[model samples]
Target chain A: MNAPVLAVRNLTKLFADAARPDAMPVGVRGVSLEVARGEVVGLIGESGCGKTTLGRCIARLLDPDSGEVLVRDVPFSALKGHSLRNFRKNVQVVFQKPETCLNPRMTVAVFVREALRNFGIVANNAEARKRLVELASLVGLREAALEQYPHQLSGGERQRVAIMRALACEPELIVLDEPTSALDVSVQAQVLRTLKDLQTVVGTSFLFISHDVAVIRYMCARVLVMYLGVVVEEGPVEAVFGRPAHPYTRALLAAAPRIKPRAVDPIALRGELMLGDVRLDECPVRVRCPLAHARCVEAPPEFDLGDGHRSACWLSADTASRSVSPTAMKAAS
Target chain B: MSADAPLFQIDGLTIDSIRADRRRRIVQDVSLCVAPGQIYGLVGESGSGKSVSMMASVGLATTGLAVQAGTVRFGGVVQQAVDQRGLKQNLSHGISLLFQNAKGALSPFLATGAQVGRVLDRQAIPRADREARISELFRVVGLNHADLGGKYPHQISGGQAQRVAMACALATDPKLLIADEPTTALDVTTEREMLRFLKRLCEDRGLAIILVAHNLSLVSEYCSGLSILHAGQVVEDGDLGAIFDEPLHPYTQGLIAAVPDVDEPHELIPIAGSVWGGSADIDRCRFSHRCPFAMPRCDAGIPTGIRTRGRNVHCVLYDEAAS
Candidate 1:
């Protein structure tokens, strides 16, 4: 098989609290994932669960303290000067707030053209103009809207412009960090549909990061559940969401407000997410896990559950071997 | 008051934002009747005037906005909505409001406990019982008074700050609580917890709540009845279950179709055009521009509510007499 478009190896980044230096720094820790060519991989987590940090780190917007991000087997950090600048063209990032990310002074056309010219993606003004129109249409923006400034456009339009700017570079992979969370449901639907179609047309891999589980389920083929800086569960979207292995994943799915109510009672988590010292030896979610046991004091390895599904919980070992139901395991515990 | 009587009622409410001698009607002919201990949802998009209607109903309409017409009936007393003083007096009677940003709403200088204490002081609770009452309020919202009471708003997490805000709103033992997107800033689990807490408060204290939110699914889960507002008009209002099951209005159907369902994966059909806020005096259906089945009659005037299928829907297609 061809190499994955983007591969992150044991990436770790921590933000030291200057005011409270002794407090445990909060950020991604020893997280690793890969996005195959043209694949959409989703990262789901609550606020401050390090999903955003992970996205930023992968996009190289924020330098990681450790680990390496490789683009098609080429390490990002190994590239230097001109090579590093060239490597950046392979990945682009779309932030949550379009108003903040976009330049108020520049029109949508000029904003997108800047990216095209900066990367030398277009030969001349004629080509840039043509590319700008193409990019705008790709993200569902009308040609007329390209002439308007960020302030003149609506929230949905501004977001589409941001996406257009990212696509201007013709990057192989795009990191979308809560791209549609700020939008209204109707507008969000339009943007998501546009994105899904754009992905197929462009064949660009997407690392979709969002707190909304329903969106992740809809957009991604594979899913990773993050908690307190680590991936607790990772697998096919159907296998993971349909039959979640981790306790956090179950609680998150249960907590998501659904149009159709669930047949069974939602799995109630214990308490709110508390950010403290990151103890690598212990399970990150043990404090909130309803079925947490003494074995959880020591961190569990990623137990393979076949079909490429893996969960960082000791209980999965019984399920993999004995095919014991999760409910039965909960009952036993 | 009778057990079944509405705790709070707003009738034919209209609000106008006046600037430079020009008046733009922001909220028009909006009405809602919330019974005691009932959770009524006011669901709409940003410019739909959900917040404006609620604020004007309580006489807290911001600067440059004039309450042109409406009457608010609370507990057996009826007063004109234009009477600011009369509406303001209802706060003392039993009305409390909760905003989306709990931290911004809270006093930064005051400790969490002191904030709740200040509300109690305003309500004329005995000075001797203020501290105990504050602690009880905190506990009631599922926060530890001893641990979080002394912390300022900035020190605590978002969830704790929201609980502190909830405690302050509950200080007067309010009969009607107007929570405007209270859980929008919270995490999914935390939002669920907060909504559940609010539901329990309604059941235990007979607290009537008007939950104003832009999220249809969140409102669908907790609220028994709801009013879907669009461009300052009540497009649909009635039982939540009936509307969710068979949405009559085109805009309502578009909204329900737009929301992504977690349990069921289906194609999302977004409304073609954005919300259009029509001119104040036009009196036409604001949603007519985006309505797929728009007819010439839709341009004539804003369709009044037509009772059908156990709900009130305002649309030309639902007009039985016209048909």
Candidate 2:
């Protein structure tokens, strides 16, 4: 296919633990992924699972300690000054909390207009006003909303402004970090529909980061399941969700609350995510994985499970041979 | 309709507020009856007044709001009024509350153990037995007393802190627990664990719980009965199985259709029009403006509750069924 819109290779970030200076906390450890043009790729993980950090790294909001972020065959990590500013205009980010992200003093109109001005998209005042109105209409916001301040607008309205601002410069790739988690379900639906419509109209790829599995299933065609800063599974949404190869992926799918109860009770994942220390050699989810073995101490390689499905687990390595019985799997959890 | 009286019951609960010199009904004619050992759900979106109604029932409604009409009865004892101080004094014996943010509800200065111990102290438990009782409560909520007891509120994780809060709530051995979005702030796994613990608690202790949450799926799984609120009015309330499987009210249908189901993915159609929270005519149907099947008669008068199958739905569409 044509060059992917966004490609990240071995991105790693380390933060020092205040109490234990010797232990280095890996925010995004050696994460490599790609998002094709117009594709809505989902990144799912619990809080502090490095999904947000990875998104920020891709958007260049946070400088990665090491590795490369390429935007359409261009090495984004190497760009500096004017070129970097230009690169930033192509990639925009919408955070989880809209109230904090939006300026309290700025009106909805000025927010979108300011973004257009930063990108140098509008020629004059007339052009900026027209563009701002168009962006507002695109996100299903009324013209009256443009006159209101951030505090005056409702949660759903403020989020619309945030989305409009992200779309102000016509960014090719938008990173949405838990955009709907804050809004009520009814309001979330409206915002999600707007996002889907805009993506189709603009052909902008989305790196959607959310802990809500249901939202991810609805919006994303492909998904990456992260555990402790490492992606344990990556594949087509249907393939991965239908037959999850990794233990972590299984736990997540099982944990998600469904409208209708499942035929069999879902396996409840016991224990919390173990953070701190550098167990670089071993699998990140090994501590919580039910099928963890002695071989897990040494990092498990990403095993191909056919049809572009891959999982980082020792049990999945020999799944092609069907050596591990179903009973063995049930006994472990 | 159980042989015995409900553990907690509220009827014709109407709360009004004066904003901008205009009287508005914030919670209008909302009612619920929770039987012992039954986990009843009060499901609604923000500004729906689900939280307000619960707060009013417990005499916790903030100032400026008055209960014009409503009777709260707990264990055959009728409360004087919605905001009567005696309601708390009488109900405090068997009613406890759990909020969304356990960390915020907990005192920053006190140790986790001391917090739970404080509740036991009010019950007049001997000082010598308080320590052992606190540890038992901790163990019941799946927490380790020895390790987490001494730590301050900031020291524990969100899930662990929530469990500690649960322990504190259970200290009074309450017969009825009013949990408002207890798992909303927690992770999916943690939420499930907490809900399961709650379900078990209901079965083992025969405790009745009023779970107020926005997530329909979470409420459906644990709660046997539910009430769906919209703009301060309970549009639908009854058996969870009936309301969820075949929602009658357009608002209830819209709310369910809006949530994306992971197990059964489908196109989510959001309800049109924002919830009208302003002072609408009390005689008219509140959701009539947003209802897709709105008729001229809907604006004529308020629609009373009509029984269909096994639930009560307040909608003009069900007028024929009521007749």
Candidate 3:
């Protein structure tokens, strides 16, 4: 569309063990996805599936071992020193644990002020407080909340504070790293609403990361599903979530509760990981795919199902025609 | 009001906490009843003290806050107000806990089956039946018993580990299961499977449960009766249907309003304030300060009574005059 506000290309981040360089420490392999301008993209996967690491790397919080992260056509990996500072000002992040992320020693006002001061968004305390209030108001936080410490604020309020702090610099992109997972359901809604409202008003691109499919489906218009640090499926939120072409995506949809449990709901994966510790000759998801035949283990390629939908599974093209297109998938734009 | 006698009854329990030498109400006079086979869901936000109340009733919460005044009558017998041995004994064989993080709950070195077996052994089950019982429990929780029980905590996936934890809980066929954020650590699909399995197992075996969690829709979909805890107080308690369709309490309304519905993507209107921990100024309604629909009389009188719809609401909004 608009050449995505953020574009990632072959972004692979590896955590090589200090003791054993060959050994991978949790986040391994490499992958890349992008967020379009004024678009909410959900990165959905299980815990420790590299979604968090991807968000961090996009926000430039974690340097990729060997991958490229591009913000607005500018390769962030290519930046250094002052250029990196400019890149940092363009992209910001909000963590899952808002209270822990916040400085308990600082008041809510000071927290927002730190971001503004660091980014040169404001010069004086009065101006900083003014901007902080505007940011706080966007998230439905109270004036009195500014005076209170992180500990004094409620879980929801603390999250709002985190969002305000993230927005203090007025970045073009925000890495929402399970921003509301720690919040109460009610507070989570409020924070998400604030995020959506902020996006509508600011036109900021969001790389929303969450393990909750329903939440991702609700907040994001496009989504990319991750498995073991690899992008197995990526497509429009409605299309992919409605009728997941990928076997893993289909399995995840089947596993999600809400609708009545199906007597014979097909599981996406067969057992364990798509690709074990060692890569197979076949597709990573094939070992778990119900449709996996002898063709599975032989390096299955991602099938282009058109309509901006792509899946890294051999059976996607064959099975996409048969799977039920859930009505929830059609509820999106 | 539904069914009289239940497997476990936490009647009018109040837990007072002393933080920095200050006495405060952490769980204020919460009373709930879980039927023999019913899943009595206790839903609320982080500070709602859902965890503390459940833990305290079973003598598992923070140490300082004593059960100021309440009775935990399990198996139709009144245990001491806060006896470690008594509550634990009542909770051990009679009830078991399942946390969201099962990996942390288990030992890294020991086999998954060994963990479950150890618990069964502690409950007087013979060691010889451990493998059979472990397999049964594993199958019950949807794990591949034939292959994975011998594996360690790290051996299984998140969903598998959670099932292993569930297997450990089911080792004794305990009368009641206390699952605190059980599926919080699992993926959405795995979480869905776990929920279905747990609910089905409970129904099939008549296993009563005290399911304490923060998810309202899940509780609404599964639990029959629930108590909404807020700032150490149960602001609302009744049938899930009534609470969702027509909530009487402001806090309850606020909570329900916050859930981002799948069909309806409305922005979340988060509850305005934080929960008071160990605060002595709990004379008025615990939610009075943040209740947008609060009345002047609310500051003067603390609301603690049943609503018109046969539901308990500890708020001034339910007062006859306010109504």
Candidate 4:
């Protein structure tokens, strides 16, 4: 819609261990997605599913081996010098651990002030100080918290400072990698609210990466489910969560313990967890898919479920026609 | 109070940390009880003393921290401290602890099987049967003995390592297990699997477990009862479903509301005000500074827990209702 704030097409990144260079573990393979302006898009997957790699690639923190990244129609992957600096200013990243993301020696003010200075936005210390206070207030941090070091601050406060640093340059898109996963429920709530409030105010598009399905459902408008570097499913958050088409997505939803148990029988995924990529022709989840068949071993089809909901699975056509539940499919398989 | 006494009970447990010759009460009159085959959750934000109180219960409290006041009653016996050398054998026979980072807790030098054998060694189990017992424990925890038992802590995945740790913890056949964020390091899928296994362990073996976590939903789903800690004090503690249905404490209400519900997505209402350690120095309500419904009386003294409808809440609102 109106040229997405950020766009990725056929992104691929391979990470090979130095000792074992011949067998490269899969890291974000042929992933294509987009984040509309002011929209919160969720990237959900289990650990080592390449969600973080995808976030880092989009933030330009890591260079992808292939594919293209377009920031508001401007090519991001090929930019250099001044264009690269401008693109960096247009996007920012906040990591899971605020302690590591921030310097222990630096005060909260300096941590955020440095971001502004690096962006060349503030001219002098006075201007920087003013902006720092403003940023702190924007994230619900008190004025005095700016004087304390990261260690002196609470986990939630440190996370707020991290968010403020991301917002310091006023980027058009912010990539949040498990920002609230580290904090407690109450503190996580505060951080989540602060983020939602800030997004509303700044209208910044966010690529939220988290393994927490509930947090993703609450904070993101659109959801993308990844498995072994592949975007197995993508759809509106409610649609995907309410009626997940992909077997992996459905399994994830069922696995996550909810406040209230669902009426459907829990789909117990069979087979051991397969790490990295060994073969690319068939579906990545074929080994673990409870409903796997010969077709799954041959080809992975991306089926359109309408309303921007799509999934890669061999049972998509049959499931679509029958609208069979995950438990039913599991029982049949 | 001895009628079917809890498997493990801690009452009025106060912990103080002394630094630079100044004593600060970190945990104020904390207490909890766990019965056989029950999952008791202790939920709180970081620095809320949930971990500290737990560590104190097991006698693993860090240096400079002391249990100033409290009684730990385990298996119908009142003990001064859990880590007392005189009670080492009894403690080993009765209690087990699981940490957030199982790899760090495990000895890197020893193979996974050897570590479990060591725990068995503590129980004076004959060396001949230790191997068989280790495999049995691994099987109980859903681990392949040959594949996982031979690997070092570094070799196994985080989830597998955690299961290895669980196998070691269960080596003594302990009656109660203190699991402090035991599943925190694993992915959501792994976490669910681990938790389900733990639940089955409790039900099948009659092992009482204290599940400490910050995720309200996880605690709610798995635990039957829980204690909500705020700034080292138990703001509320009772039936998990009861608290979820009608949380009496403002802190508990805020914490519950803050959790992102997958089924019913709504705007999160984050509790205002950061919890500062220095605030604990005051004798008043620990959460008053951040409490939305705080009144002038809340700053007077620590509110005592008031029981209502099978749950206990230490807040002025409940205090008023009690009066």
> What are the per-residue Cα lDDT tens digits for candidate 2 across A80-150?
99999888888899988999889888888887788889889998879999988888888999999999999
Per-residue lDDT of model 3, residues B13-95, tens digit only = 87888778877777777788888888888987787788888888777766677777788888888876567557875666688
Kindly report the docking quality category of candidate 2: medium
What's the number of clashes in each of the models? 0, 0, 12, 0
True-vs-predicted CA distance for residue B155, candidate 1, Å:
2.0
Instruction: Report interface Cα RMSD per prediction.
Output: 0.8, 1.0, 3.4, 1.7
* Better model by lDDT: candidate 1 vs candidate 3: 1
Flag regions of model 1 displaced more than 4 Å.
Answer: A321-333, B1-4, B277-281, B321-323
Provide the TM-score of chain B versus the true chain B for each model in turn. 0.96, 0.97, 0.93, 0.95
**Of 3 and 4, the candidate ranking higher by TM-score:** 4
Local lDDT at B198 for model 1? 96
lDDT of every predicted structure (CA atoms): 0.87, 0.85, 0.75, 0.83
Q: Is candidate 3 or candidate 4 better by DockQ?
A: 4
DockQ of each: 0.79, 0.74, 0.43, 0.65
Query: Which order, best to worst by TM-score?
Result: 1, 2, 4, 3
lDDT of 3 by residue, A1-333 (tens): 578788887666755446555533446345667778889889988766789988888888788877698888999877899989966888889899986789989998887888899988888988987888788788788899999999887777888888888888888888899887877676577677777878899888898998877788778988998876677788987788777877778877666554122457666444444223534244555545677778665654556676778777766757443322211011001
Q: Report the backbone clash tally of model 2.
A: 0
Candidate 2 C-alpha lDDT tens digits along B1-323: 53266989998999998767878888899888999999999998888888888888888778778888888999888875565576767788889999999999999999999999988988899889889999999999999999899999987889988999999999999999999999999988788888999999999999999999988888978999999998888899899999988999999999888999887789889987677743377877888877889888887876768888789999878888677
Provide the lDDT at B167 for model 4: 91
lDDT by residue (tens digit), candidate 1, B1-323: 22268888899999998999887888889988999999999999888899988998998888899999999999889989998777997655599999999999999999999999988888688888888899899999999999899999998989999999999999988999999999999999999999999999999989999999999989888898899998888999988888999999999999989988887878888987777533345578888878899888887887778878878899989787545
lDDT tens digits, residue span A45-100, model 1? 99988999999988888888888999888898467789889779889999999999
